[model samples]
Target: MRKEKVHINIVVIGHVDSGKSTTTGHLIYKLGGIDKRVIERFEKEAAEMNKRSFKYAWVLDKLKAERERGITIDIALWKFETTKYYCTVIDAPGHRDFIKNMITGTSQADCAVLIIDSTTGGFEAGISKDGQTREHALLAFTLGVKQMICCCNKRVIERFEKEAAEMNKRSFKYAWVLDKLKAERERGITIDIALWKFETTKYYCTVIDAPGHRDFIKNMITGTSQADCAVLIIDSTTGGFEAGISKDGQTREHALLAFTLGVKQMICCCNKMDATTPKYSKARYDEIVKEVSSYLKKVGYNPDKIPFVPISGFEGDNMIERSTNLDWYKGPTLLEALDLIQEPKRPTDKPLRLPLQDVYKIGGIGTVPVGRVETGVLKPGMVVTFGPTGLTTEVKSVEMHHEALQEALPGDNVGFNVKNVAVKDLKRGFVASNSKEDPAKEAASFTSQVIIMNHPGQIGNGYAPVLDCHTSHIAVKFAEILTKIDRRSGKELEKEPKFLKNGDAGFVKMIPTKPMVVETFSEYPPLGRFAVRDMRQTVAVGVIKSVEKKDPTGAKVTKAAAKKK
Candidate 1:
């Protein structure tokens, strides 16, 4: 028998206390993938804590501080196999400090599932930092995905299973937060981990989960970039208004970001109808759909084209199971929605380009350059050159994880034997590719589209931040601000911004401390990539636009081959 190979790499993300772990656990169990030993251990632990209902999902609480604080601190990876696919669930922390990790994770995902909570309803008091929700939106815009879904969780308190009752209970709660919401009052506990899938018609998906909460916001950003699609989760009862407004506001922000990032479609889930009045749930769902539709309209999307669904992840009602509770509601369930998502198009035939993620020494291997292969094929005996240092190497061998391979190409994770290159010779932010195909060299002047993050407090004309390009990190300063453009419309924001702010997206010229490989976005996206970082955090992301021409100094000599030709 063929080793039954179907893999779906997906992530879970959202505001904190939105039940990311719980939802993830539920999916594992619902799919019959959880081990009995793990469940028993969790039961024993829950018994000690006096919460019998706590299942194996608690095992996901890996960190001591996370368990105590009820928050995710790091991104966790788990695996489960279905009749149709083997899935890897990446659980990312919702905190702000972990945003870098989140970006890393998002860059690896193919699709995403965004979670929201019903208890707190929406953006709670003190739940954000410097308008982090807005930041999340901005980051999501960079993660060009196709499918976006939303889930509203935690209506379990009402105990109403009827669709009508859930609708009634949903409308009772409203006006929680919006512009007045701060970053302090947001709960850190996740009540459920919602799931959604985005599919494109072209390539298999790698999904991401961005859970809410200051702790896991990083996870959301990282997860989103890797995904080709995404989903939003909301609670049907308590989530009605919360999902419609505060939570809805955030959803719009994220959705808008996704749209800006090139996401083509999305699905919204109204979870937890089992514990709410059918009337409240229905009313809430209607209201939420209307609000989301109106927002989409304002943002240039047709209102009638929006997709929303209602379900309860906890009770397994309308999630993967067909609930007897809603015979009146005729539509596909959450699972069906997931199944319906089409995979994104794969630009595998595009030019060979690799984003240098890291350069490290591996014992006998000397120096190793690690990064995801964005396009084309990597083969042995092929001569490749990395950024600026312009070190040329012959591909002696290729290895991934540990397995040896003759050649690796797009989507393959492998390392090459770069002879004569030393640990000190190669650093992060350098790319290794066939020099014959790529232009890996320093440019004096280049246009770049940058999303400015946090810049240094003491600003100056020549202040430089550590630039993160693929795996290479070097000191780079903005040489000039050619023009500022609207992040959304690409319309000019300012002819020049002396100082770019937190959410600004504009084009500018930069100078690197050292000569490094840089290229125009049109020619080599891999070498064109870069990120800005202060000592504390990542400040921005960008791609080189074009290179400025320089004057030739050396005496020109005609090549013998050229003369002969």
Candidate 2:
């Protein structure tokens, strides 16, 4: 008896110069050998196309059959059958322009094949120079396969392991951190956020390990925005320390971001202490602390108050226990420094401000708006007002993962069904707040303190760029350049500067291109701090100092909300 063939979907992805198309075509061409005559026909077809006898043109011969020459933007699908399974392959384009197609292909793929040129300069042509191998990262994040989340290196522990196993020597030191998500550790890089909550000596701690991957900078913003304290990890080895703290390093960038995003408290861990030339050298540790402290001061942090803890993450020295290797150091261990952090007051007592992440209409549920509560509490009986249009509705039910809750607090992502609210009436950017208490409205214009971190060109009045605040992404115009200010002191530096260049801090008045809900940093923090996104990168970051709100006009109120009022 013959058995039925199972179906499989494979996606081919890589950098533009990485021969994705060539690899895909070769696979199909070789599979053509399954039918011996088909291979001969392909050779005949190839010979006819390359009658010019150009060996260099032979590279284009196979693609010519597919009718695509230079850089195929669209995904090409092909089919072939094996003895046990039927396979469908998608030739997903590798260029950034075709990211949507790549995302589409990646999501549908049962397996993804990343093609590499492997040749000298061909490998250097794209992608890899930056820390991320974006192809594998896209696949890992999209599929959420392999949990790649055991902090992706437990960064190698859910329970911190004591020094054990002689095999866990030299490079094996980090084996424990990567052991949890062993597969990704083979890549030897953690390209994404590693969020793990564990109790320290004094407080329950959440470590949002924001690795310095340029592609995931937005993740850094999101992680630091919620953090009460930032754990700054640094390389203490000879060249490693210099490379990490240099102008091009991401450590300085992250520190600046953390300070800008309101992570007032921080613990600077001088990591890889064991790897120092003389082994846990106090001289090396002091040198790093001196340089980092000066850099932190420029970023607006009071370096004197920030604790510098020396530790080796790989060797597990001074992370939880004091390192005898460095008896010269008297400071508390990593865990002890964490215990010193003073908890910031929770915003639950403030007026409710929940930025909608998504809106959905279910079979039985009317309209559900899902978001994390940035402040205050959300309950079933409350009258909710959505900003921009001031659409009002009464919350019929509040649920987290299909289970009803009495109230949802800050940081709780919940989907609440609203009475008389249609799906069209809500969207991701809209702010949901208590109807009768400090309700959110659209902003006409706002004043903000913006620091240009990375911009290809100068930013001046009338330069409109997309601003990412909370769940909203809107183009906001720089209405006026008020004054350039000293980053550390916030003192006026220049009056109405012609333009703000990279690393310049200035007060600017902004006008949104569309309806956007924003509040002063003092009032609603999550909605106040925004990333100035331009050219597909976070060119600048700003904190809303003040807002001029537009009064609501002809706003819609649900029947349920009206009756309650």
Candidate 3:
């Protein structure tokens, strides 16, 4: 008579010493949720501080000054329940001044786990040069955490004896164990961010244990921007997933920023595979599923629906059984591929929008704001408007995770309240909408299409940068580039291509140095997708398609009807 469960939040990130809180305290003590007399009092205080290999990272580092300065500093909530969902497990904080409590615990996660660190200078010093594992997988697809699970952690690969004596003094190949783990990433080591949960027999899960540490890529982009599907974790020994996927890899920049933050489902796993040798872990799992399906189809994804598996998360085998050492691999195990992922599909007829993000005021309850609707249906008295600051107001009440919600739909992360609007006339990327439906504009010039992915040189035209979109970031420019296409057959390969660089694929036009709003990606694909950034990476990724507006000048009634003709 009681079967309601189904809830999830998960966050955990990576880098700084990479074992992400001892593989999330050994996967929440192998799912029984600890308490064997609190792991023998944390193994008698880590064997009297000899640090008995950090007793499962002191089960979430419970600060005795974080287990005598072993690391993990803040955000570490927990809760477990599985058998089909009801998890929480945040666990962020991998050092660097507790990355703003790991971006406020990855902005209240929804999914993410990204650990990495398979020993040997730990996954090339957590993704090399000050690695926050490719900036927490590009800040979890720029704060939209569309699902990720990337584990790796090989339980400290038998404490890499001097990275296996500098990889047998450089002949163990795999590019000399990635040039001796990039020369030991400036003396690396230190880790945390741990969470745990498990379930199958259908849905309900949570797991975020991020942190890979290039000084905490802004808390791994505020915890992989709220994932939806990702489970990379390589390390199948032999050179641990070829030193985390070479070319200064954060596992290929966290699987190309989790497939450009939209995560179309993935699950590579391959972990320790019982430290290799089932014929070298099935030829390093068919050479990492043929180099991660040809680098996820050259960054657009589709590698035959993605799913590699072959687990071990420290001998748990295919991660919940099913590993007769590769009986020629048959798939589904990382908890049945996390219950076959899927999820996504909330558009809800589109239109309403939302954005905003934070406004508050609440003394008696007036100008709230918040965010997360991301498309149609809001309700509660309605009227809305918002946008680049067009204002309007009305809503009055909606709430959500805290209760009172007459409507609010599409992924609901509400807050509402509104009325005449104050708290200094609202802020945070505005947007809202619904005043009369399809009511949000501003652009004055759009067009997009993009692709790029990294710049360095050749972009042409004005090229301002910083875009972001959903929850708007702003500052665009570029002005025009019109056509360059061929991102795999869009054709047109040149109509204005004087420059474009890295993986091209243009169409351009942009503009937005100010008034933004947007919508076109065939009509609001979660605020018509975007990305761009510049000096901070994320080169490009676009959408929009068309827009213009701006007219309105009237000019004294067309100069008095042209002097009365």
Highest-lDDT candidate: 3
Task: Encode model 1's per-residue lDDT on 1-565: one tens digit a residue.
Answer: 0135233444444434344455555555555545567666555544443333334335444443343334444334444443343344444333444443334333333444444333333322101222222233333334433454444444355334554422221211110000001111112222111122222222222233343444443333433333333444443444333432342233433433333333334444555544445432555455445544454444333334334556554555555666676555566665555555444344456656555544678775676775545567677766666555555666667764355766665544445666666667666445555667653555566778887645545333466876544334467778777777888798997886676776778887788777655666566443455555564344666767888734323312223212322
| lDDT of every model, 2 decimals | 0.45, 0.49, 0.51
TM, every model:
0.65, 0.59, 0.34
Stretches of candidate 2 off by over 4 Å are 1-195, 347-349, 356-374, 388-430, 451-457, 466-474, 483-497, 502-505, 513-515, 531-541, 551-565
Tell me the tens digit of each residue's lDDT in model 3 across 246-266: 544444454444444443444
lDDT of 2 by residue, 1-565 (tens): 0024333333333333233333333333333412445334433433333211111112212223122122323333343334333343333333333332332232222333322222222222221212012222222122211111000000111222432431121222121121112221222122222222233323322223222333334433333333344444444544444433443333444444444444455555555455455555666666666665565555555556656666544334555567687688787654455444443444789999987645889888788986557789999999999998899989999975355989876644468999987799898679899988999999999999988876878998899987756656679999999999997699999999999998899999999999989899888876777666566444677789999998799999988899999
Q: What are the per-model numbers of colliding residue pairs?
A: 119, 4, 40
Note the residue pairs that clash in candidate 2. Answer: 150-154, 153-177, 156-176, 156-177
Looking at model 3, which ten-residue stretch has the lowest summed lDDT?
171-180
- The residue ranges of model 3 lying beyond 4 angstroms of the native Cα positions read 1-114, 119-132, 135-152, 155-223, 226-245, 248-383, 386-441, 445-453, 462-468, 471-477, 480-509, 512-530, 533-537, 540-565
The local lDDT score (0 to 100) that residue 345 gets in candidate 3 is 57
* Angstrom error at residue 365, model 3: 25
Decide which is better by TM-score, 2 or 3. Answer: 2
